[model samples]
Target: MKTGVEKLTDVMAHFLGHTAIRLPDDVIAKLEELRDKEDHPLAKVIYRTMFRNQRLAEELQRPSCQDTGVSQYWVRCGTAFPYINELEDLLREATIQATFETPLRHNSVETFDEYNTGKNVGKGTPTVWWDIIPHSDQCEIYTYLSGGGCSLPGCATVLMPGEGYEGIVKFVMDRMTSYGLNACPPLLIGIGVGTSVETAALNSKKALMRPVDSHSDNPRAAKMEKLLEDGINALGLGPQGMGGHYSVMGVHIENTARHPSVIGCALNVGCWSHRRGHIIFDKDLNFTTDTHSHFVYEEK
Candidate 1:
């Protein structure tokens, strides 16, 4: 007889294993669309290889990238949930299980010790960001499997108050020119502008959660989205940086009014595959699962 806590751990572990390797359907569609538009021969070849590799990964149920990534969970836990007491521990145990079950490449390295967790159970493995709300008994979770290659070039900077909005554009353009190619092109760009460095950085990552090609709610931000998209695509970094029709699949910007004295900004990039997904669990444990921007799976 399994306890609710045990069951929860197992369920999360299973889904993490499956989701970590699968590219969301929308991401797949965007890649295919780009493959058709690319004119450079080598870029085209890389695109085709990417598609075939995706298929092989799915068929074999193996990870699309060997670096199964540092598992990160964005959890919206209902305050009234029955197992609230153990949620954090459950998540950690699930990560440990998934690391080996998925045979996830051990990616968590202890900073001072510089040793791999070997089980993905280091100090902050499967970093979970929790949101607690009232009057609900269920949790809505988004698991983002972010690879280091894509995350390595993430940046944040504070502009002087006079830098104004255009300054953001210049920063993004400059960074992309220097390191964008390293992130595996056709990247999804997440820009965050807020009053503090940490908040801006987090908002930037949240921006990637928006659907591919989606625009900001504010009209001015929407315009910036277009400007950034056009500028990045013009770079011709293309697929795998070989050069072609599109370098960025899309750009999403998130912002908040800043302090009069400071301008905070951050940028995080997601590779072509952008592995992330959502699962909403009801009080009874029934759920609906959606895979990233593209893949969808239903459980009966």
Candidate 2:
């Protein structure tokens, strides 16, 4: 009989494998909506091709892109959950198995060694971030496949107190103007403002896990999202960066109270694919996921 940790690992591996090929419904919907909004002839063709590509990947049961990307998980674990102690090991094993089963692109090359791990598992690969929840027995996981191209344009900086919020706006506008097209626009832009670079950077990436249409809760932050969306779309990079009226699907901002002397801001850009999913597991190890709710997994 399998241990609870083993069971959770197996389920998560399968979930990650499926996520590579089948996009979430929300992403598909957004892509379709963007497809119709395109005025440029070639841009329309690109969107159509994108749709067809997704269909073919699903039907063929293969990855949607050759660069399946480095795996990353954001985990919120209830302190009362039984498997909390085992999550790190469970996630690592799952990622190793998924690399072969999904046949993910062997993207993890050791920097100093200059050789591929060939299994997407390395010292820090498939990085996991954790948040502890009080008084609950369920764990929620957000998985993201961060492809190389999409990860290329991520930027972060600390702003002097004098620069103000407008500094953040300028920083984002400058980055997008310079490299936004590189990440395959109609991008989902995530902005994080915090007291330091690392916090801001982490929050920026977390913001990407939110649904594309969702906005920040803080009114000030929400307004910033709107302004950034409008400013980016006005760039006319459009679908696949071939030039069109819409350059981004949405802008999201996540923020924390910052030091009075400094403001740190970061940007994470998700391409049109926006490959991510969410899953929840109870203490019993029974699980549910929004990304692949239709598919049933059998325990061994």
lDDT of 1 by residue, 96-143 (tens): 888887778898899999998788878877788888979999998888
Q: For model 1, which pairs clash?
A: 24-295, 25-294, 25-295, 26-293, 26-294
Per-candidate TM equals 0.94, 0.97
The prediction achieving the highest lDDT against the true structure is 2
What is each predicted model's overall lDDT from 0 to 1? 0.84, 0.89
lDDT of 2 by residue, 119-168 (tens): 88887988999999999999999999999888988999999999999999
Model 1, residue 14: distance off in Å is 1.6
Candidate 1: clashing residue pairs, number: 5
